[model samples]
Each structure stands twice: as structure tokens, then as C-alpha cells.
Target: MTPLLSWLTAVLVGVAPPPPGRTRELSTRDRELLAVCQTDQFRRVDVRIASIVEWRERRGRPYRTIPPDASLPEGHIAFTFDDGPDERATPKIRALLAACGVYGHFFIPGTRVGGPKARWAIAELKGLLAEGHIIGTHSATHPSFTRGVVTSRDRRRELDRGREALEATLDIHPVLFRLPYGEGHWDSEVLFEISRAGLVDLHWNITSDDAKDKAPKEPGFQGLTADEVLARIERSLDFSRRPGERLGHGVLVVHDTNYRIAALLPTLLNRLVTRGYTFVRFVGPLVEGRDAEEDTGVPRRD
Candidate 1:
């Protein structure tokens, strides 16, 4: 039987045998086969993928610049974090975001959700979702999306598998994505792969430059202090402003991989609030509510 026909048969039988050693985690090909099998169940897949392709073909700008009026809050600014669900730092960060009544977009890799021995990250992910923060797929294993050596097929797997893993764990599929390391070129193949997965690329206009602190360099490397990082963020916000420019939206990128930024999150949020900026959740594509149970053989209990 053809792949589609086989997958359809499996779906009808209600027992599609998973690949060897991957009973929980669905591979990219598995998702494709399933997508082909239950076209009605995934009717939105083609439309969403087409939207991504059209956006890529047009070289669509970041999601912030075109915020729908209804989604905008007074003094809007989007706070996005990457490379997380950090065990030591995420709970603290979640508390901080909660105290401030602001939502952050956490772009996470599937690997961080933990394995058999440890399962704290999955709890943290669930907590983040429970607290009303938006989660976006960072990648399956946080690979560099812009490196020329990474093939398009691998990139698609990263996007598709990551989404599958997250949806299985959180029970909600995410439609927002960011390449690992925030690396991308205009109209790159990586972008097309992202578009193929029915996700919107949410890039940041401002970076906290916190990675410098995380890089344990030799003495005199001169990394920015938390204050300096906040200053850089301030400058970025200023640069985006024009004389008589309306309070348009912008996305700020920060990391939760280390404690430096997490420790200083209060300072950053305070500055923004004091400056009349309202923290707003990202308004983009999302999977509405939970779906049916999925056995993500990847073992992390939530």
C-alpha cells in the first residue's frame, strides 16, 4: 500500500504501530502520514501552511509590526524569551511575570521537557501555560536553523516534531515559532520550512544581549551588566520610536537559559511599566484549547 493508504488503514484500525524505540514520540514522517490519513481532522493544516508560504514569499515582517487593533493594549511591547523552561530559573521567572500581570512568550525546545530520570521542566511548562503565558516552538533539539549545512528536511522535522512533542505534553498546539539562536536570513530555506509547519515566525527587534553573560569567557571579556542590558533594551525601544509615531508594537527578545536575566527581570519589567508600557500577550495563531490525548512516548509527565 502507498504511505497515505497505509496510514489511512492504520487510522481506521486505530493502532498505527509507532517507529522502533519511538513509541511515544511521533516522528516528522509520522505526523505527515497522519496528516495525510485524516484530512478532515487536519483540514486547517493546508490553509495554515499556505499562509506561512505566502508570508515567506512576501518576506513578511515580524509579527509585532502588524498587530491587530483589538489585540493592542495601551503602551504595547511584547516580551519574548527563548532557550528555556530552565529548571532553576523558570519558576522564579514565572512568579515575576505573574506579579507584574504581564505575559511572556516562551520559545522552548522539546528536549528541555525532560526525560525519564527528571520531569521538572514539564511541570514548569504546564505552570507557564496555566499562568496564561504563550508558548512557541523553538525547535526539537534547539539546532541552529540558519546554518547552511542543515538540510531542509531536517529543518522541517525540527519544526514538526517539536510542535508534536509540545502539543502532546501541553495538550495545546502552538502556531508561533522562532528559530534557535534567532538566526535567519530573508527568505531563507529555513523560513520556508517554518512556513511549511503552519507557524508564524516571531522574531524580535530588540535583544537583551544576556547571552554575553552566560558565555563564561576569560577575564576582561567585558559583558554587559543587567543594568547595561536594560539600557540596550531602552535604546532599542527609543530607536523604534519616531516623532509623532504612534505607539506601535515591537518584540523584545530575552533568554531564560541562565539566571542573570531572570534575576534582573523585575528591573526590566519595572522600567517598562514606569515608562507607560503595557505588557501584552502576543496575538498570533494558536491551537484553541486542549485536544485529544496523545501518547508522546517521550517520557515526561505533566
Candidate 2:
């Protein structure tokens, strides 16, 4: 979903990049295809995948193995931002996270680190490290990991490239990966590749649905007042509830490109806090690549 941030990232051949390529004039057909590909319906393929997963568990094939509460308190929360390290709003969020004294995870683009729009992303990541926030890979170029859709070999190369780039730029080997669009058959082929790369695939408990949205076209939202986008995103938090199931902690996912994200942060954080949720970063062995996450949260009773 955050494909641009992931794909347009820095390459490992020493950050001194080639002269930028000339912009190609895109046809109307190209633009239409781009919009359709980025829509919610296109991404719902992942939802179907998840539903099938939940169903498999119904048939006695458990997919997740949620961790026991090991001296952890109830209502521990974590705020994670994906498709980041932008010179734009990412650092702002990091600063806010720092003020809250909560350690969150930043899933950054490996190649984009030293690039123009996100060169500061590397510095921000360094600051995050100093402040105890964990760093994870969002993929080398943010491409699909689907086997037939994108050759498995290419997926490995891209993932490994990302891992290497993140380590080189940020000086820390990334331990977690949020698959591009959160798509992939996590139990088989994708898992095999992730395991070999020594990284765990991390997905969100709550998504802000920021990627699928296109900015307003008329007058470019020049004088819009208040935080409409944030209000919509706040509604996403409602999806985190699981009735009688102990949902464990929540990791909220949002993009750096959202309009008024900074303005909405205080209100959202305030609401989550009012609900007794405190931010807590992932620290399982799976994230460290010792073993993959058998389960990321508590499953429902059949």
C-alpha cells in the first residue's frame, strides 16, 4: 500500500545514486489503472486471505499462537507508523511519541533512506533508535510477495535487499516486516522466505485506511478547516474490539501522508488513553527472527 515509499528507496550500491530518470508523460489509461490498483476493493484480497485463515483455524488448524501475558499489564497499546522515514511528517510523529514516553515501531523503506524526500528518514530512524523505538522493514521496494503474482525468487531478492539496506543505513538489522499491502500466504511460501531472511512478518491490528484515499481534487483542499481525515481514522480504532476475546494489545497503523495527522494525534492518543490503552512495542522472539509469530493476537473460541 505504501508502495512509493518502499520502492523509491535507496539502493545498496553506496547511497550515491544515479542521476534521476526523466519523468514519462503518463496517458489517461495509466492514471486510471493506477487509481483502480490502489483502491480498497483491490486491497480486500488480503481481507479474503485473512478470512480464509480464520476459517482454517475453525477446522483445527490454528494459525496464530498468541503469547501468554508474561508480567504484562492489561490494555498495553502500541502505535506504529508504516511507509515512513519521510522528511515530512514522520519525524513529527516520532517527536510526539517521544513526548508520550511510549516506544513504537517505525516500518521504513530501505532504499528511500538516503533519498531526497526521505533522506531525513535515516536521521529520524537514528533518533528513534536513541529514543528506544524499534525499526522494521516494510519491504525493499514494497512489491507484492504473492508467489505467482511476483516470482518467489524476486520476492526474496527484494526482501533481502531491504534487510541489507536498512542495516546499512540505520546500523541495525531489521527484525520485523509488514508485507506490502499486508498480502501473502503467511504460513507457507512467504513464511519460508521471511524465515530465511531472519525477519518476522508484522501486520496491523488497526488500519487507518490512509493509503487507499486520494486527496481532494477540487481546489486541493486549500482552506479546509478541522481534521476530517483524522476523524475517519479514529473510527478505524473501533475495529479493534473483539467482544469476549482478549485482543491483547493493539498496534495502530497510519500513513505519514494523511492530512492533519499531527493535528489528530493528540485527540486520538487522548481517546486511546481514556480507554485505558497504553502504547507498547512488540518484543516477541518472533520479531527477533528466532521463530515466526504463530499468533499475533488472541483467537476467538469456536
Candidate 3:
């Protein structure tokens, strides 16, 4: 087959031919491309020669890049949740936040909303927006954007399709994105794609480690109970340990999909409140005193 035909065939099958002289050490672009070809995003769409041409034209140019601001106040923390809209966990999590009078940034999986098995997810999603919570794309499905196994195209699909899913379901476009597994494997090209997609990359500096139970059964993998998780968070709040560190300021990560998070959040919030950490949502930028403007706050799907 001709090279172009070979490439098309690979995409159709959710694979990307490794670059020439490909090895375990893949270049950033190659890794991004591989991720794009290997992920489930493309398989959900109808691929055609014309569509490929359009993608080529629009590849580097993202169609909502909202950059976040850097002026968060002291004692302010942004609580971000990922891999959710899960029925068992999401509603409880929402109620807890509401009771606490705080908001969270929910990075939702695109596939879960409006999927055959997750029709209820749309309502959960809308409920989040209605209740003054922030939403953003975690991906069409959660995958490591930096893993060598997927391609840049896969990364793009992850960003665009996930946003499209949100816009379609909620009638609001989001510009915030969280790397599925955080920043472990991130590189320049991945950052470029984030800009190309017009998204501000939001990674966390503090963790609740609330998903400890989800860890695989391997070495150094013990689970934490709700009380232990609270203790871990408390330890992280010790400003004396890292004096010059962003004292009283953090982008805290926790997973809503984790049952532990839903169970422990109330306790966690109470502890943080007692410690004087104020909860705030990232609405593109951090507004110092009051809530973010409505345009940047909870969006109405209408």
C-alpha cells in the first residue's frame, strides 16, 4: 500500500505506524501521534480522505484556548476532580460541596456523557453547572496523553472531542484541561497541543491521594482509609516544611470517581476550613476577593 493509504488504514484500526527507526525512546511529536492513532476517539467517528485533509489544515490551531491567571490569593486552593460524573460518587460529592458552600472544578470524561450506558450522566453534568460548579475536559476517555503508545492526533481528538461532547450536552465550551494522569510524562509537544487546542493545562501541586484504593496491587501500594486520607492532606498543608513554597496556595487534585473521595470529602473540607484554607474554583483566572464573573462561573446550557 502507498504510504498515505497505509497511514489511513492505521488510523481506521486505532493504530499508528511507528515512525522510521522507532524505538522505546520516541520523540515528543511521535509519542503524541502514536497516542492519537492508538486511542478510542477516532474509532467513534467516520474517517474519510476529506476529513483527514481538514484535520491536516486545522492540526496546530485549536478551534477555545483560555489561559489561566496567576494571581490567586494567599490561603486559596483550587479543588479539582477528575474521571467522573459517576452516578454513585458524583451526586454525593456535589451535595457535600454545596453543604460546605464551596465549589470544585470537575474534569469530566467525554464518553461518559450521553453514552448509551450513561444517559444519566448528562443530568449529573447539568446539575453541576446549575449548582455553580466548574466543568472542564479530562478527555474523551482518560488516557495518558504523554504515553508513547498514543499519537498527537489522539491527543487532539481527546481535547476536541471531549470539549465537543461538553458543548453538545451542556451548551457550554470549556477551556480548562487536566492531564489524565497528571504531569509525569508531559513534554513540550504535549504542551503545544494543549495550546493548539486552545486549552490551559491545569495540573495540581497538592493531592488528596483520595484514590489510593484504585491503585493496582503492586509494591508500595497500600490503601488509605478516609481518616488516613485526611491525615495525609493535613501533612501536605504544613507550610513550615516548605517555607518558600506557595504557602497557602495550591491547586489540589482529588478524583470524584473514587468512592473514597465522596466518602472523605466532607471531612476533608472541614479540616481544610479549620486550617484556614479557603476553597475557590478556577474560572480561567483566579479573582482575588469575590466569585468569578458569571461568564466564567457556572454556565447555563441555554
Which number leads on lDDT?
3
User: Candidate 3 on 223-290: residue-level lDDT in tens?
Assistant: 47667777776666554224455446556777766556655665566555654555665553322243
RMSD (Å) per prediction: 17.9, 14.5, 18.3
Q: Whose TM-score is higher: candidate 2's or candidate 3's?
A: 3
For candidate 3, the lDDT comes to 0.60
**What alpha-carbon RMSD in Å does predicted model 3 have with respect to the real structure?**
18.3
Instruction: For residue 175, give model 1's deviation from the true position in Å.
Output: 0.5
If scored against the real structure, what TM-score would every candidate get?
0.67, 0.64, 0.67
In Å, residue 280's CA in model 1 sits off its true spot by 1.5
Q: Sort every candidate by TM-score, greatest first.
A: 1, 3, 2
The models' CA-based lDDT, in order, is 0.59, 0.53, 0.60
For 43-149, candidate 1 gives per-residue lDDT tens digits of 11111111222332435632211221223333567778888866545666676666556678899888876576227677777777777677888888887776732
Q: Which of the two candidates, 1 or 2, achieves a greater lDDT against the reference?
A: 1
Give candidate 3 regions above 4 Å deviation: 1-71, 148-150, 184-186, 214-223, 239-247, 284-297, 300-302
Q: Which stretches of candidate 1 lie over 4 Å from their true place?
A: 1-74, 116-118, 214-223, 246-248, 283-302
